[model samples]
Target chain A: MIQAALTFAVTCFALALVFNLWHLARAPGVVDRILALDTMVINAIALLNLYGISQGTPVYFEVSMLIAMVGFVSTVAYCRFILRGNIIE
Target chain B: MLEDTTLIAEIVVSVLLVVAGVFGLVGSLGLVKLDDTMRRLHAPTKATTLGIGGVLIASMIYSAVFLDRLSFHELLITVFLFLTAPITANFIAKSYMHRHVDEGDLPPTEGPYGWAVYDAVPEDERPIDTK
Candidate 1:
């Protein structure tokens, strides 16, 4: 059961990553592209967590947490740049 | 008895994983399909946050039941995600508004000052009219 669930989840997130890439490639606006990228980061985190569960290890937990922090900071920096024309005041 | 307990744990973890994946797919789908920028922003923030939360919860359970060591590390990721997702969304929305939305299109703030993104006055220099 766990193996089947892992396969199903991996497939779903892989599809999601594809969708995010599609959106990123042809996004109508810069904000749309940024949003797509942000979603991709989130999907990647989910993928990492699922892989950790399947492998029965806790190592990926720290990796995913780091990715989450970096992703959030990058997204915020991108937004700040767009808002103020620079990332830092 | 031990086999039954392990089987139940597997079932619980499997359900959680499946549900999380579905949420993740739907959130990405919404990101692609939603027509408006603001509307598009709505999809990933709420749905993917929950999706990741579910996965983390499942990971915690799996580690406890299968690996035989209780893990609290996933909780930190979950909490960090919940705290940051909203702030990230807000910044994104602010940036989108800065780029696409006009001051005229927004309803006036009840406060005397304009929206923070657009307000030009320094903190102490603005007028203090009450009404």
Candidate 2:
């Protein structure tokens, strides 16, 4: 049952990827693109979690954590740069 | 042979995975299908984070039932996500408003100082046409 669910989850992730990519490719503004990228990272985290369960391994959980950190920091940095016209400022 | 308890665990994991996937997909679809930036901003921060939460719960269940050890580490992802999703949403909203959102769309600033985004500049620095 769990295996079946994992397969479904993978399919859903593929659909989500397509959506994220579509948004990324045609985003009306830089901020929209950044939003799409952020969503993509979240989707990637879900995929990694599913993969971890399918393989019965715990190691991927750490990978998911790192991705979350990167996604959050990058989003904030991108927004900061756009807002202030300089990231470090 | 799967014990009844094991079967129940599998059921729970299955549900979590499906729910996570659906919500994640909906969130991404919102990103693509929404008409504008602010509307698009609403999608992933809320729905996608919840989706990931479901997946993390599934992972926790898998680790506990199959790996035979209780693991709280998966909860770290949940906690981190909850903490940061709103922060990202706020930053993105501010960036958009600061960059291109119409001044009319912006709410009245609550204080004598203009909006937070405008405070960095002296009131004299703003173009007379901006407000």
Q: Output the number of the lDDT-best candidate.
A: 1
TM per prediction: 0.95, 0.90
> DockQ for all models, in order?
0.91, 0.88
Off by over 4 Å in 2: B121-131
True contacts kept of each: 0.93, 0.96
Model 1 clash pairs are none
lDDT of 1 by residue, A25-88 (tens): 9999999988999999999999999889878888998999899989998999998888888987
- Winner by DockQ: 1
Candidate 1 C-alpha error for residue B100, in Å: 0.6
TM-score of 2: 0.90
**Candidate topping TM-score:** 1
Give the Å error, residue A74, model 1.
Answer: 0.6
Docking class of 1: high
Q: Which regions of candidate 1 deviate over 4 angstroms?
A: B125-131
lDDT by residue (A1-89, candidate 2, tens digit) is 88889999889988998999988998888888888888888889889988888888889989999999999999999999888778894
